[model samples]
Target: MEKLNWIAVDWGTSHLRVWLMDDQSKVLQHLASDRGMSSLKPEEYEATLIEMVGDALPDQGSIPVICCGMAGSRQGWAEAPYGKAPCTPPSIDAATRVSTKVSRISVFILPGIKQLPAADVMRGEETQIAGFLAENSDFDGVICLPGTHCKWVHISAGEVVSFRTFMTGELFALICGSSVLRHSVDDEGWDAEAFDAAVSDAISRPAAIAGNLFSIRAESLLSGLSAAAARSRISGLLIGIELAAARPYWLGQDVVIVGESGIASAYEVGLIQQGAMARRVTAENMTLNGLRAAHAKMVEIAQ
Candidate 1:
């Protein structure tokens, strides 16, 4: 087995991912579990982490554990607190150390960034941005991270100058699963044409979204609209409204969508419709890179 030097963790509300790394920061092993911050208490965090990677720990010395995401939230292992925006992602100096009963590990949780004036906060996405800027140091534009809560961040001089969050993904879930449109949407087929038309409609008149959403169901029952088209349209309507609000961030700016999900692809399509060019990068790669960047900063601090 490759020698384990340290560990990297991404602990979110819904998932826990760990990477056993060598001295060179290469991943030696990858492990994950559904045990997340939402499920674990303060004391349980250490035990939960040990349960996930105890067997992989080195024998002679304590291994440094660098973590990002919700694990550092106020209710997480230990509150790493929020670093204000216009600053870089937290380095080792800003990390909150959680003393553990396990002598073999020293855990550090990196702080997330907060946009106070906008009342916006992000946990895991900050690290992704750090990792992104680590690679593309010259990049000066916006990064759109589409998920349950999408973030549109503006990067300037390698710092997160400002940002905005949109709950478009969460709204889609609630509307499609529990709202009157539930019957019109399904998990099958895709209609790019329908999606494009809905996006155009929503962009041109974002204020009509509520009425347009009901139209999906109305048209389905009256005109026999396909469930697939309805699903696509639901997604399009939500994203289109989001784009309308986030226009200042992406207008004539280089946009990069960091995610592997279908929603990421939808964002790319939505942006293209508005005459914006976008590049796609896998979320996992950006995350691991972010972890790697955090580790590098930690090393520099120790030296």
Candidate 2:
């Protein structure tokens, strides 16, 4: 049996994921829960972690735990704080130590990155950026992290130089599920032709997005546009607007999209439509690789 030497955690606003890892960074077992930062009090974090992984924890010595994401937010277990940008992701020295009632557990939450002057902060994606840099040390370009709030980051010299956030995903959910468009969009299907056309239309005339949005409903009523197509257009239009605004980041630059959702694919397509070459990597794998990088650095510090 493989010995569990440590724990890797990614606790976000909506979910918590834990990985039991060996000394060599091989994952032994994994678990996830819906009890995220928004669901727990600061004092309840230790108990919640124990409830999820107590059976797998070693009986003798304390196992080191390295975590990233919203768990480091001010309202989380302990504020790991934010390290400034144009800098590497924070390591062991920047981690926040959490005192556990259980004797065999030692937890450290990694600090995230903050961009001054513009006032933008990222919690979990910085670790993934660290992981990407760990492998592609020579990479210098843009990385788009697609989620509730998509981030477009600039990387140079193994550091995050600058970044911007767009509320495309949240807006999609709001407009599709709760707005007037909700009556027209089924939000459960895809139409590649409709998607591409919408991307081209939005990119060419981004300022006309308001009228285009109403067209989704008008067309549905007047010409019987399908709900699935309406959903696709809505997604494409928002992402298209973001691309118009983020042209400086992705235009003529190597682009990598980090995420594991359909929305990520949509971003890829939107970029390709603008003649930009873009590739995607799964967020789960990137997060695990990032935790591995942090663990290696922390262990090195201990030595």
Candidate 3:
């Protein structure tokens, strides 16, 4: 068996994923940990990383590590600078590295890209963009990455022109779990029709979203709308507002939604309502794939 050459890690705010890859770029083992950046102290990063990948590391004192996500943020172990937006794959590939305590390991921390005009910044999506580039080298269009802060990235000629971040998932969590709507909505299950209606209403009158959100409780209290449906309505309003903002960028371009099933569904519904043809792509291992791609590119450039 070939020896391991590098370790690819996607250490985000809430989860840590480590992959052991052989010289041929095949993953030998994949490990996950809940010790994400949000939960660990700055000093604990090294120990956590070592604990996750120490067993599979080689003794040559030369394993190149590549990582993305919040692990490179201001609160992360080491800060990775942000690359300005309107960047290409090569620009992203040219991201700088952050050093670690491990003498045998060299860590390359990818920089997040920001669009100054829009005040939008992303720490990890750049790596996923690299992964998308790796898979569809010739494609140029809009890619929607749905998550806690869903991002809509615009790519053309291999460059990320601009992107927007929507606080859809975070807002949903806050409203459903902590806000007044929590009492009206079910924690599980979705009402497709109500959700669709809310999306439509929000899209038609985007400015009214704020007022509409407050009305969720009122409708549930006075009009007898089910809590589940109200929850779905709030989700639609937030997602619809996002879609309304993102409509201009995706107006005539092909759209691809990357992320889990539920969020992808919401994005698809919103896009379809706005007359865009959006396709969903499961990004189950995109972080690992992205880290591997970054590592390989670094090795190529170094040679």
Candidate 4:
């Protein structure tokens, strides 16, 4: 086994992932479980972490553990506080130490970013943004993170100028499950042409969205719309509305989609159709890169 130098963690709502890292920033071992922020109490964090990553640590000296995501939320192990926008990705001096009883480990959770006056906040994504910046020091424009709650972040001069979150993913889940549109969609399928058309329609006729949404079910029952087309349409419509709202961020600007999932591909397609330059990156790469960057910073004053 490779010698472990430190630990990198991404503890989200439903999963806890820990990567034992060597000095070269390479993962020595990855340990994951379902004990996420939502399932554990505040005090159980340290013990749980040790139970998962303890064997990777040295026999004597303590090692640093750099973490990001919901583990720093209010209900998490410890609140790391949100660093407002117009500032760099909260990884520089934003890490909060978790009081650990284990003498062999020290835990630090990175702070998130908040946009004032608009009531928006992000915990884990900021680290990913930081990692992107680390790779593209001069990149400016939009970075779209597609997930349960999608985030469109505007980056300039290595800072999060502003951002907006859309409920596209969650809404799609609900709509596909039991919404009036459920009868129109299937569990899994896609129609690239239909999707692109729906997206185009949504962007071109933003106001027609409310009425257009109902047309899915109506068309399914009347004109016999295929389940695959229905699924794609639903996805397209929601993502289309998101594009319309986030037009200011991506219009004539380079976009970086930091996820390799199907939704990420859909976002890339939708943006390309809108004449935007969008690129792709794996979620694991960005998250781990962000954690690696955070660990470098944490080493500055790591106790």
Q: Top model by TM-score, which number?
A: 1
Lowest lDDT 10-residue stretch of candidate 4: 294-303
lDDT of 4 by residue, 36-93 (tens): 9989999999989988987777899888888899999999999999999888998747
Query: Rank by lDDT, descending?
Result: 1, 2, 4, 3
Better of 3 and 4 by TM-score: 4
Query: Which scores higher on lDDT, 2 or 3?
Result: 2
Residue-level lDDT of model 2, residues 162-239, one tens digit each, is 999888889989999888999999948898888888888888899999999999999999999998899999988888
Number of clashing residue pairs, candidate 4: 0
Each model's TM-score?
0.96, 0.96, 0.91, 0.92
lDDT of each: 0.92, 0.91, 0.82, 0.89
How many residue pairs in model 3 have overlapping backbones? 2
lDDT of 1 by residue, 77-196 (tens): 999988999998766688888889989999999899998787999999999998888899999999999998999999989899999999998899999899989988888899999999
Q: Write the candidate numbers in order of decreasing TM-score.
A: 1, 2, 4, 3
Task: Please report the candidate that would top lDDT against the real structure.
Answer: 1
lDDT of 1: 0.92
Which residues of candidate 1, in runs, are more than 4 Å off?
none
In candidate 4, stretches whose alpha carbon ends up further than 4 angstroms from where it belongs are: 300-303
- Greater lDDT among 1 and 4 belongs to 1
- Which scores greater on lDDT, model 3 or model 4? 4
Better of 1 and 3 by lDDT: 1
Candidate 2 Cα lDDT to native: 0.91
